[model samples]
Each structure stands twice: as C-alpha cells, then as structure tokens.
Target: MSRRLRRLPAIVLPLLLATTLVACGDDDGSDSGSGSTDALHGITITGDVGKEPEVEWDGELKVDKTATEVVTEGDGEKVAEGDQVSAHIWIGNGTTQEKAYSTYDQKQPESVQASNDLSPVFKDAIIDRTIGSRIAVTATAADAFGEAGNAQMGIGNKDTVLLIVDLMDKQVVLDGPEGKEQPAPSWAPGLITEGDKVTGLDFSKAPEPDRKLQSATLIQGEGDVVKKGQTITVNYLGQVYGGKKPFDESYSSAPASFAIGVGQVVSGWDKTLVGAKVGSRMIIALPPAWGYGKDGNPDAGIKGTDTLYFVVDILAAS
Candidate 1:
C-alpha cells in the first residue's frame, strides 16, 4: 500500500549546504582548482574481509561463492531469478569504520530484509547472493536516496559506505493450499475467537479481495463507529499464518494510536477498521494482497504472495 508522507524536516536544506561547504574546503586529494561540480563525484572506497564468512550448503542454502570475505572473497550462490533471502547486516564507512545504519540499532536483527530491485536501497546487490555470504557494496550519495538520504542517514557528500551482510534463509512463495495454515495463536486482553484465532469485535464485515472498502463494529464507547476523521489508538501484531512467526508487533511498549482510516495504518487495516467501534478486538487474515504483496521481505526472508495474520486490540479513539 502506498501513502504520501509528510514533507522532509526543515533542517534538511541546512545539512545539504553544510556538506557542500565541507566538500569545497577539503584539500586532501579532493577537489580540482576548477569550480566544476564534478569533484563531488570522486569518492574512494576500500575494506577488509572482517573475518572469513562461514558457509554451508544444504541445497536449499546455496550461493555462487563458497568462500567469501569483505575485501576479497568468493561470489556466493546465484540468487534464483525471483527468490527472496533474509539477512542480518551491519553497515559503516569502509575507510574510517564509522558506523552508519545498523540492524542492531533497531534491536530487530532478523526482521530487516529487502526484495525489490529498484528504488529499494538494499535490493540488487544482495539479491541473487547466496545465504551466509558477505559482500561490501559501495554507492554514491546520489545512488543512495539523495538529500533526504543525507539528512535521514547522516552520510556526507563524499562518504563511502560498507555493508556487511550475513545471508540467513531464503523464502518461497506458495500458491493456494501450498501456503501454510495457522491455528489461532495465544491471545491477550479484549480478544474474541472465531476459529483458533482471536479477532477485534468492532468490524461488521470480513476481508474482501481485490477491492478497498470500509466497515465498522462497536465496542464500549458511544459514537459513530470510528468516524472518518477521528483519531484512534490500536494495538496489533503481524504474524505469518501456520508458522507462528511474528513479523511486526505494536504491543511491546504501548498500544499504537493513529487517525482512523488514515495512511497511519496499512490499506488493509484502513479499509477494514473504519467503522469498528473502539475497544472491540478483531482478527484479520490477510493474503499477500493485503500484506507485503508480491515483493516480500527477502532480507527478513519473506517470500512474495505469503499470507499474514494479525491480532488487534483497540485501546482508544479520539
């Protein structure tokens, strides 16, 4: 699902200007006496093979290269044309070792994966690379995400990045019954049961395929079933059906609150919960159409066309 986002922070322009100034003033093998903008394009990169990459092949886990490292290594397995892989990765500056973005920082080392070849930053390089292999990919600031990239990532104009990745597993897409079936998982408060799973009680309709629609159900409060513009709070956990593997959860620290039917939630939730009364617990089983869709999370090892389940607890509506 796509939703237009808020504008970039006002300070982004200032960061871009500062990076330009720093690039112009550097005299250490950078910049020409001439005033051409081409100097900004001269970024050099180098790296060490942190340690030999550990590798094993079970036929399922195959890479082009059996032996791989950072500076010099083997080209791991060839990622099948459409296969998606999951990985654990750490990124930093290849020259100075300054840590940039890291999966460790999010405390979500396994859930971060990439599947797209275009626009997605992590795609292309790691796609087609075998499991448990390591590669150092270098991209220009222009090649990254650009100005928003610099402000959001804190990378400088001439900065070079080194991404150290560990391939974990590859995900396979399932069609029809081939998909795993999940029984209901353990439930917390305000949950109701239809089958083995618990669901939110506020919605009036079940899920619909290939269309967008809104339905509402009531819980405890008195108001129009979550009106179009009202702000609301909800708690939800996203899990793979049949496997009980949770991909995302908002129940760890506090229940999540957002505007009803807004882009704050995925299109599936927005369409399903518009009329749901607050305090009603509902369950949603979403095929890939309502979930991550065809481009599954390869980095987290999710395949395209996978089914997903969610348990939602409505905490507040405003």
Candidate 2:
C-alpha cells in the first residue's frame, strides 16, 4: 500500500460483515412483521434518509430467535439478492448494554452484500428493501457469533448483538479514473500508462527538484467535492522520483479506503485530495518534509531525501 494513504481497519466491515452470523441455511429467512412480531422494535431509530440513525431504548433487548424489523421504508434504488448495498451499520451488545461499533464514528458507510451468505437476522432484515430503508436486528450470541462468542468485544456466550442498519444507496466503486483527460502539467513528472492503467512516473525530463509540495490534475471529474475528515476511496500509484518503478500501487490489490484531510494520510495527500471531486485523476509531487519526513518509509526503499510523486484516482467520498 502507498504510504501517502492511510490504511483503514484491517477489516473494512468491522467483523467481516460479509460472513455468516446465523445458522439458518434451509429457508429464505424470516422477516419480522410490524409492532409485536418485530423483535428489535423496542429500539427507536430516527434520522433523515441516507444518514446514520439515532437508536434509543429503555431497557436491554433480548430475543430467542433472530429478530429483524423494518424501521423505515426507503425511496431510493431497489436492491436484489447478492447485490452490494451502501449501508451504515451500528452494532451494540444488548446483554451488556454497551455499544460495539458505528459507521458514523468511522465517517463512512460499509458495502454490505445482501446475499445468502449473510446471517439470517441480517439478510432477512435487508432483503426486498430499497435504498434509504432502515432495518434493526437482534440476535443472541448463539445465533450471531455461534457458541464461542466474540471475546474481544466483551460479548459472553449468552449475550446478543444488536444492529441498526441504514440502507442509504448502492455502492459505487471504480476500476479506474472515470473523468475527462486534461493537459498534463509541465512541472510534474511524465505519467507512463499502459492503456487506462498507470505504470509509473518518469521524471527524466521534469524540472529541477524542490522541497515544496505541488499537485496537478490530469483528468477532471464532475462529481462531489471531497471535504476534510471524510473517508474517501481511491486507486493510487506512488514512486520515489527518479526510481525505475513504483513503490506501491492499488491496481494489483484494488482501491484502498481511509480518512482524508485528518492526518490519517501523509500531509501531501491530505492537502491535495480535499476539494477535489470523485472520478478525477490527480498527481502530486512532494519532498520528504511532506512525505514520510526524515524517517522516509524504509520498508518501501524510500530514503530520507527521496522526492515522492503519486498518481491518484478519486473513486468515492463520504
């Protein structure tokens, strides 16, 4: 991974949100009805569509079977089985009365799969629901994490995990920059590309090196402008100027996600990426002062005096 970007949690969905959490494999799963049949109806969810909801309840909520409730109906895109949905999830321990996780805190929504692989409690809650919907799920540890339970989260064998999910919109991921090509900057290094893919940065004919940071946009995209403290996704390639090859790139592994303009990434990326729009492709040139500093990323073979350059494709921002 490029040191210019910050690495999100090793697990993007927290507890691998794609894995099965319930053992209900035979049926299509059960969707709880309104009012009495709603297992997680005790908790209150309130908020505008496409945003994280506020959850509240008077007492501990426990359910014998995996219970799901459609907290609110959505008016956005319709989803189907196995399709990926952009959702904000909040997990809490009903037995311990403590909150476990919330996407609001992370400042981004997770891409959850509405497929059979998901737990019965979650799949049943989300299936047939359109974007902008809100679903609440309640299940015991036996039904959620199985018998052993998640020790790190402090959930005992009998504890239950409560989740409130807001299906905001469909996830938008890009394989490359989806923007119009612009004239390359004369001051920056030449971009070597094989078709739509960026291969490396060639600084052979570039201007004399300087310590100050600089940036240039190669492709202009008309998408939402990125802001400070928002989590953004991008495909990037980084190299030490004058080096033969790139030190790291997202083409091989895929797009990476992290908080931007919040010191989570190097200062060069934080200052350059913000105010840019999604789908734009930009290049940045920064000296050691704005890169890894005196302790230039030795693991990537970067030296203290290495002048770093990066080619980035802004994919998504939230």
Off by over 4 Å in 1: 1-77, 94-97, 105-116, 119-121, 173-318
| C-alpha positional error of residue 113 in candidate 1 after TM-score superposition, expressed in Å | 6.5
For candidate 2, lDDT tens digit of each residue in 77-116?
7778856566778888887678776777777776555766
Q: Where is model 1 poorest over a 10-residue stretch in terms of lDDT?
A: 1-10
As a TM-score, model 2 comes out at 0.70
Clash statistics: count for each candidate: 26, 0
Overall local distance difference test of candidate 1: 0.41
| Number of the top lDDT candidate | 2
How high is each candidate's TM-score? Answer: 0.36, 0.70
**Candidate closest to the true structure, highest TM-score:** 2
Computed on alpha carbons, the lDDT of every model, listed in order, comes to: 0.41, 0.74
- Minimal lDDT window, size 10, model 2: 1-10
* Residue 23 alpha-carbon offset, candidate 2, angstroms: 15
List where candidate 2 sits over 4 angstroms from the true fold.
1-4, 7-68, 80-86, 106-128, 139-159, 171-175, 203-209, 229-231, 242-245, 297-305
